[model samples]
Target: MAYVLWEFTILGFDPTSFMFSGALIAFSWLLVNNRMMDTEALGRDQLFYATHDPVILMDAAGRFAGANLAARDLFGDEIPEHGGSLRQLNKIGPMLDCLAATGELNPAESISVGDRVYDPRALPIASPIQRRNNLLGWTVSLVDITERERSAEALREALSRAEAANRAKSEFLAVVSHELRTPMTSLKGSLDLMFNGVAGDVSDRMKELLGIARRNSVRLQKLIDDILDLQKLDLNTLNFELQDVEPTEFLREVMRDCEMHAAQAKVRLSVVSDDAEGRMHVDPYRLKQVVGNVLSNAVKFSPEGGNIECSLGATGDALRMSIRDSGPGIPENAEDKVFGRFNQVDSSSTRASGGSGLGMHIAKILIERMGGAISYQSRLGVGSVFHIDIPLAGGVPRQSSPPCDSVPGDGEGVPAFGEVRG
Candidate 1:
């Protein structure tokens, strides 16, 4: 006897009624043939046939036994006849062979049908009997991933374009900075000479105007230098002369250089080197520039009579340098913005302080390029502390030390330094 396994419900027949008749026919056939029925497998087959994603069932012989509505839609109305070899279907034969050999789907393999891309997966159906746990057939599911693949391709293209644009922008900035430097240097020198009475003695009013011009010209010159440095860094063209340097001597030099600025701000500068034996491998000039930038910022923000402390110590194959400033601390929300280019904690405050908002960003880039890391800790009412950690030369292990506090001279009293103003 022959029975219809599936009928189109669109053809004026209720799907529930057709399913009931099909089930009754299957049950009667099993009883008449004196064969045992697997109700669990039958229920699973019914559910599989109702799935929205295309599902195909193949018997142990690799012949198509059944397909779902989605599968019929995918393959067209003329699906493979019952017991027909699945190899006849396009791009499905190799996947079936892979599944038969490995008993699992190859996720990396995919099939393209028309404009859609599908990743095929296979699962073996085992016999229900405990003693005979053998493979009865296989269930293949095709998951369409065309949209996902397209989205990934689009993202890769966008990333490539963004990188190209960044390279172009960096190159443009480098060229523009070089062109502006020559004229700016000449203008600044002329202004400086006039202000200093080198060009000729002038009236008090004229001297005051020249002084303003000189100061602003100097500020502009500094901004141009910073832009050039940033561009060089971006292009990886900045040169470094790496050498072993003693931390104690290095800290002393940096502290000496910072004293002028600290004095100008009425902020005392002091250094404490607890572990002075460690040597750092870095470009002294570049490292000093990084340190100077941090010191300048500290001095700029620090209130009069407040102290700026520089400390150096060793911790596990790395040398740590921290700058502590008694200033209005960085706000919680503005902490992260400090390292971003042209970003300031408060634009109005930074403008009044005469900064281009690039000092901290440049310092961060310089430290990172020298194989060091820069970070800071701050509180709203207290003060701010910036730390730089650089690995020691020759990878020598550092001597164990107590955790460095965020505040320099936390327990130690601030030492006195004689007045040294710029």
Candidate 2:
């Protein structure tokens, strides 16, 4: 009977047996939690694998430690399960070259992998696990910039073609100018003889008609001369004699010379200088051309009896000169085009304005050559203002500054010349 009770007791659910069963259940729950954490970590790694940019980790001994999805996709099954293949390393040849040269590579570098050309970069990193040892190595990254490289190459090719075309056009213009000038010169001489009665005297009506013809011929000749001058400037053959010039005196002389033209247009032209006396370091003749072009435009654009203002001042180590005109102002949209060659505003004003359409372009080129800048502003139906800013030389005097003991004198000044040789 005692033995039978003992066997039954062992089979029954006692306190000790219940406690052991509860401990087992707790341990199982802990195991489930641990598995959940591990799954979450694996999911994060998988997410990194799907990115397009190739990522690779290598040890100090150049052994591949790990690779992302992109690296695997590129190498396929060829990449070893442990250390990467030499073929994989050689794939980014250009990237390696850039790294060798610059100690780092950027995404802008050109590279190739397999049959595909890739613009990629390789970045070197110190071993994270053991900095002084080969336990962990560096990480290399690559990005495909093939599209960017293609676009850049295409742009370079297009630029080359455009430059070739521009050179050809410039050559053609220069040849045409030379050919045209020879015949025009002959025509002008013939007209001069006829006008002077060298050929024969003519009746009153005939002479009047002949005078009109001569005037139109003169205007045509002027246009041709402007074209020739523009061509010379383009070809960089415009001979300039450089010298020191007094700004106040130079402005006065330019206004005086342009007085006749301004009077003919019935516009008042004047100069206002910040200093009564100051000198400039430049090619005086070329500077005169720049100023003359501005003055002529101002005079032509100003309404009759309206004010034409030319003001000069100092601006941040530069001499600033502005020519302002009171006329039907420039159209806002067409302002930029005005600086381009042969470009004029499409209006009655531009048509009525007699010019070879090279004045502003030539002026801009000349000013830029002199280490200066020219810009303009205009409002429709109001007025237009053109500003020139030129850097001052070391010896140049300011408004209230003292002058040097030595005053520069004109030596072999620019040759005497008339307007357009008409």
Candidate 3:
């Protein structure tokens, strides 16, 4: 075999003898690999310093090694220089200790520097080479969140103001309703006396005029009463006298009371109580108001000659009452808003239907307060069904004490619409 020879210098000193060409080529490849590794390390350092977020590097001994321009601006002259211990730095030392113990990249911690809020995070750096896989320290960063905190504080204040305004409005309505009811009661009585010819015999024209006045006065009185009830509900002062009563007979009586009004609307009212006989513990007068409000709506909305059905049934442990009316169904968009205060399915219908738009809302509130729920299903042009579900008296635990010998009043001493006789 032909002998191969190599010539090289060792650290600027000439070699004493020639070396094999294969050994020379191998040494050249090692130098090239080491140079490439150095270039990669330099590139990584450049990227770390270029980042806009404050980046700080620390040694495994918890001493500061380096920091980017952003870190200098954030910490100002307080930034540790050279191999200074991080424990000596104010505000930053404790945060660094927590990060070191937890080894978390982003901890739920914030630091307030002057008027600014900065969210601090730390990530441990490690050697990339497998053989040198050693802890290199940490890279800490800080993110500003001052604007976010300000926005959150503003939202809290706005909610507080809104709640205060609503309370004030409810109080104003309660006072005004009480003030108006006194005059309305007197006006209604006076008009009724005139219509019944209590003053004197009247001509047909005078009687018709007095009858109109009587009806309008009655409507106004009802509106005022509804407003007062709504105000009481808002203030959480509405009282209930729970009593055990027959559901079928009670529902029949309510239907019967609405018959005269339904007749005037030319709508036929029907009740179907199929095997629904049971005693329900409920406040009878409040129950009546709930049923009456629904029944009245059914009468008002039902087309002439259309039939309105009231159904009562016992399903499982609950008593369910449903009122089905043959009227223009509620629009899809307005369905969810029906139980909102002063909400109406058809705004123009309020005038024709003779309502203050509080009937359904009040009914819902009363039902809910009595531990029940009300919902409805409606199809456009096909009519609607309103359902109330109340747990049977003993089926669910009572939420409050039974009506005492002295019933709690709403401070106004207003008489509710039910007989108190047991």
- Show model 1 residue runs off by greater than 4 Å: 1-52, 76-79, 235-239, 272-275, 332-334, 349-351, 377-382, 395-422
TM-score of 2: 0.64
| Predictions in order: lDDT | 0.78, 0.66, 0.74
Tell me the lDDT of model 1 at 42: 80
Cα lDDT of model 2 by residue, 336-413, tens digit: 466678776653563676665667777788888887777766665666667666556544435432111111121222
How far residue 188's Cα lies from its native spot in candidate 1, in Å, is: 2.1
The C-alpha RMSD of each candidate to the native structure, in angstroms, is 11.3, 10.1, 11.0
Off by over 4 Å in 3: 1-53, 102-107, 130-135, 235-243, 330-334, 349-351, 379-382, 396-422
Better of 1 and 2 by TM-score: 1
Q: What is the alpha-carbon lDDT of model 3 when measured against the actual structure? A: 0.74
The 10-residue segment of model 1 with minimum total lDDT is 413-422
- List model 1 lDDT by residue over 107-177, tens digit each: 45878977888888777888888557488889898888899989999999999999999999999999999
Which candidate achieves the best TM-score against the true structure?
1
What lDDT, from 0 to 1, does candidate 1 have? 0.78
> What value does the lDDT take at residue 151 in candidate 2?
88
Segments in model 2 whose C-alpha atoms lie over 4 Å from true places: 1-55, 66-109, 119-135, 192-199, 202-239, 246-253, 268-275, 305-340, 345-351, 375-394, 398-422
Residue pairs in steric clash, candidate 2?
none
Report, for all candidates in order, the number of backbone clashes: 1, 0, 0
